[model samples]
Target: MTGPDRRTVTSHLLIAGMSAMIPARSIAATRDPTARTRQGQAKGFVRNGASIFLGLPYGADTGGARRFRPPAPPLPWQGVRDATRPGQRAPQPGIGPLRGPFADYFTGNRSAEIAAMPETLGEDCLVLNVVTPAVDRARRPVLVYIHGGGFTTGTGLVGTLGDRFTVAEDVVLVTVNHRLGALGFMYLGGASPDFADGNPGMLDLVAALRWVRDNIGAFGGDPTNVTLFGESGGGIKVSLLLAMPQAQGLFRRAIIESGLYPDPIAPQVAADQTRDFMARVGASDVAALQRLPFDRFSGAGTPGNLPVADGRTLMARPWAQAPATAANVPLLLGYCKDELTLFALGQPALFDLKWPDVPSRLAAAKLGLPPEAAPGVVDAYRSVFPSDTPSDSYFRISSDASFGRAMVTLADLKSGQRPPVYFYRMDLDTQLPPGLRAMHTAELPLTIGLSPRADADTLTKQISGAWAAFARTGDPNHPGLPQWRPYRPAEREMMVFDQVSSSGPDPQAAPRAMLREAIGSGAQYNPL
Candidate 1:
């Protein structure tokens, strides 16, 4: 892994006597193998007996005029494209300062870790990675993973757990990176017609799907059977793709894990973007906004990266209506038992709450519940979980509000229709820190074989079995788990996943009423 003795390679030219910024090991390890993607031939490396291709471009340069618009097809190349080095991530704020114990979760401390993170950011970020048992094999189910960071941060790099889905699963795993924040989703309709319904970030995902449709076969995948699966923010994209007309027919199945956001793209972003955009880049007009350096414009992402309903690509906000476009696409939706604690516990009061502080703290938590609704929520939680403390109750209530409700609601909406929705809940204990049981993103490493505990492997095997079966047949039922049932509006049925998985009635019925009353209609919060 020494940083030495190398050559420079760009899209067109390479110079001698210059050091290759990528590690020397990566350069030598991958120089022998090559595969033809739709855009061009890509050079790749090998790991764990799998062909590991990194940073393969799926769209053209997305800077200057191309900023804040749908992605253009990648420019075809004359020579082989070098995909050994990690591509630059979309520009957004990376992890800020952290406090005690919890900092371990963000630092990526897995023993079977992937390679390092990309050290730079750029607008040329619409690239994807491919990991296959062998490019020579054909018709294998393709898993196109959308990395989570909402409409903003996170890349399809090693940091996002891309390498974990390699040969072990016998599916071609594809991870993608696209535009984020202002450069990807800020609405500037006055600037141009193309930028009217601003959701360039979502469009980037659509383009990536289109790329998969055309080129995944070369990597030993069945493009017709692509399964779009993601976690956290990535799961939100999978849900959006299901409702988006532009994303129709690109894939056949969807899996959403702990993703929650409002269904429709917001009609108008609450934050004043016009003033912020102008202030950040020293540009008052869309014309001038295009001329500013992308780094400046993208880094100054304020008001967050929310998708706008421009009425063309998205007719209504995603998830608001039954997804007619995805009527025939089977869906598997689930969430971790204590999904919100990873984020909720960051508030010191919630890390461990005293019984006396419970009342005032629950109200002030501002979980979108009204003051009048707080007492009822407290009462219901106390009745259902008698032995639980205030902190435990808050964690469970927040989990149901943010993630659990959405899973059931979407499942009910998609049930008794063209394609069925199967629901599950991950309650496995990895025995991790803070003792927040089954916390958010805890299943990530386990599903990909990073688990150290013996109890986790059984659930991981069942999960992997279900995911693989779903990718192949659009149904997740297998002998590994109990008799899983498809969700129905009239009947409450869901699979509770653990060391010994089994079926049960919808677990949210009682808590949901309280949550809806408190949060008004239903709860919605974009995972940060």
Candidate 2:
């Protein structure tokens, strides 16, 4: 689904990088909400009492010569542009039907959600969506979200529509779509001068943030009080953003859900991956690679879109040391209780494992543990949850190895700094199959302020309200929640979200210790 080729507009003033401030005069109310941006004016419609705008260009199309370069500013337009429909998604291989035993359960049979997904996939996907309660100068809080598909698949349209969140919390919600997969992260700096930057996907996000800083004020949002958050891959991106010099001051607060890894792709590893990808596509040079059909790049052996340590854009391991830039920015980090269950659904053998196979099954690559430590890790979890089967224990142990342990380490590292760091564990079980407790993205519906079942309304209000409160200030505490304290090494306090949410010390203490020991030093740990 290649979009129409866009002609390069003569280089105009790039308003996104400018430091000029918009005057705070009261905005006049209009019949149909409209806002004039640096590029041009856009007209949006009111939906369910919120002024909604979709598909506003934040950066120019990354097709042709712009494939692997830093994102360019969007071209100026003559007249008012319509921004009422969803935008194109980044070009990548089709993520065909969800597979495995829990496929239907994973999707929850939500046909409406399946239908709302973006239809267009192309290189011209540097667009974003905005939803605000009003077009007046109310100066509401802004929540800017980056969608998660591990930097390869997915778009802003997937789990973060954010309409309900904006209307309910009176905050402006923005979701952005940027380059993904090889097109976005392929390392070409060592190969040719034409492709010096290998981390364009990360740069695309920086460009989008610059656009938000410049243009969000006109849409009834407080540009100074923006919160940047994402789940999974998006959370990893947030972690990386904390280390980026270009992303400084673009956001005030950050929330990372189920994505906290300490290491980024080494420069040499990224270059090797790029060479391997080029060889797979039979392209020896940048021109030959660009001339091939886009699909050919994603067909087979596509390199993972992990951000690279280019020594410029990203200096070192993202979280190996506390980023000085993020020292003042408050952070919220968490993961679901059973993050690996949804992923394990595709592997039938994992579900059928018996006690004898627990150690072997837990020794998989994602565990990030020594082979000898699997037995001890399994024992630690079994001691915590006595009624567990071998498979259940495997799920919990593997999840901690991948997400929980790393988040704990990160919280510890960040707590040493002055800024507050809050940690959480989502324990809401999916009733679809009953035992799938807080699988990977189970917190999305509630966090994004979507309507939940009758039983979940209170929980939704608690979670979503807390998120809004955090964005409004740096604290996640509100009347709906108990006195939530910042994470500290002595107590390791954390919020647990469920049908009834609560705050306490580490819930699974033994397993956390076991996994931490298995992975050796936290600074050198890598889990993606």
Candidate 3:
């Protein structure tokens, strides 16, 4: 058969196969005929003159023996693997009751958005969702996203839909699922052979990267030009991946939001936490631990949880030790305006501390400050925010100690390597009833340029344009947006995203200085 005829026959077969996988009416209604495949099957839906494909998988079921092991290659099928449905999410313990706004957010309430809930949550949760403008086989820049959950919980399924970014930027967007918490991070070498040393979760991330490098081209993504970006725990994972030897060259650029490696944790303390967990669960062997019921292994206070500084996988404490390997990759790091306010929900007393007493409480918490330094720390904070009340002062100190200082410290270290590092401060106040003002995860909608009203064009072409530019070419500069200068100790230029976004010098200058001094130059501390 001629090449054209062969392509036509192949496309037809693929369309037939995909039709069997999903609803025929939905496909017929939404699929673009003009953007048709060789077999006359639609590959994407037309949105503002661009075609969009949602939820394409990159790996197979990670169940049974595949659990705790590297992601297996997705088995090839005859027809187009329904690239529309999002695969299952990894088993994660739910936090609080799922209702109201939380349920709406998790379920994707947008009328234009497609809901891709996982059929099951188990060890077999290794999968990825892809959003591409077209499937014409032309390699486009790829953005591989990792979701955050304190290295314990969270799935790629939450709060990440590429529809806005994909159509707005005309780029391929990929979000992945990896092992989390104990099942992902537990180091088993000391107890069993199959469950040997190193971080299994990190390994899962590397496996996903490898899968992207190998197969992204099939979905119109440039494997060599992938960028890894994440928020919170996901940001921390990106930091770890930068230090990991296995992740080298898989991704070219990175964007970390609200989390940094330099946030100190005592290695021994983490190990002890693991030991206590193992002891509590009554599992001395790795096999037995693996065999534990999923429910028993999940949730808070579980054994063999959280990423450990196992010397091999985690070369050194991320915050204390400079990431020599990732030094060359361009980085973008930042935090929200009122980062600590979210913690007040769980620890109400956090909001009660007086400004002068903030430093003392933090020092006592073993946040790298000496006991005697508490008074001076408080004084320094007061001097910085002289007009602020005790509550404001306390929140500033806590936010800096936990996230802000660490972000700056990492950026400072990376800046020394001569790599372009961009910084930002998200100050937009959503004013949601929860009273979270620019809190963690708040910048997500802005980053993706999503708005509440379907008819409203709140999609700022500038933000999405910059992100697309960055994904396309390692730089976020675009038309109508101010030139984003690389972060430096001297200038400390930060891109502020708010009701009005712009690039400028440090806005929280005094507070930032006090944090740097209190945390020391490296912001390093032994985890208690």
Instruction: Write down the TM-score of every candidate.
Output: 0.86, 0.88, 0.81
Question: For residues 1-528, what per-residue lDDT tens digits would candidate 1 score against the true structure?
Answer: 121111111100010000111221233344356888766798877665667777888898788888776789998887988876777667765442222222233222332232333337788888888877787747799888777766666666532232444566677888788888778877776445656766788899999999999988888889899999887777878888888888999999999887775454454542256556677667767778789776565444464466666676665556666678888888988888777666653355575877666656656655676766776787787887798877777777777777777776777777857787888888775454545567776555444444445556677677777787788888887777788888776667888887777797865567667777668763465445
Candidate lDDT (C-alpha), each: 0.68, 0.73, 0.62
Alpha carbon deviation, residue 184, candidate 1 (Å): 0.3
Candidate with top lDDT is: 2
lDDT (tens digit, per residue) of candidate 2 on 1-528: 121111100000000100011111113324567888899999876655678777899999888888788899999898899876666778875533332223323222232333323347888899988889888788999988887767676666533344556888899988888988888887787778766666899999999999999999989999899999887778888888988889999999999888757466787888888788777778889888778776665645777557777777877676777788898899998988887766654355776679988887776655567778888878888888898787777777777877787677778888888989999988887653324556777676577665346677788788889899999999999998877889988898889898888898876876788677887763432332
Give candidate 1 regions above 4 Å deviation: 1-31, 96-119, 159-165, 264-272, 298-304
Q: Record all residue pairs in model 3 with backbone atoms less than 3 Å apart, i.e. clashing.
A: 11-39, 12-39, 62-124, 261-319, 262-319, 265-527, 266-527, 355-390
Rank order by lDDT, top first? 2, 1, 3
Q: What is the Cα-based TM-score of model 3? A: 0.81
Model 2: residue 185 alpha-carbon error in angstroms: 0.1
lDDT of 3 by residue, 167-240 (tens): 66768777777767667766655554555455777877887888778777766788889988887777888888
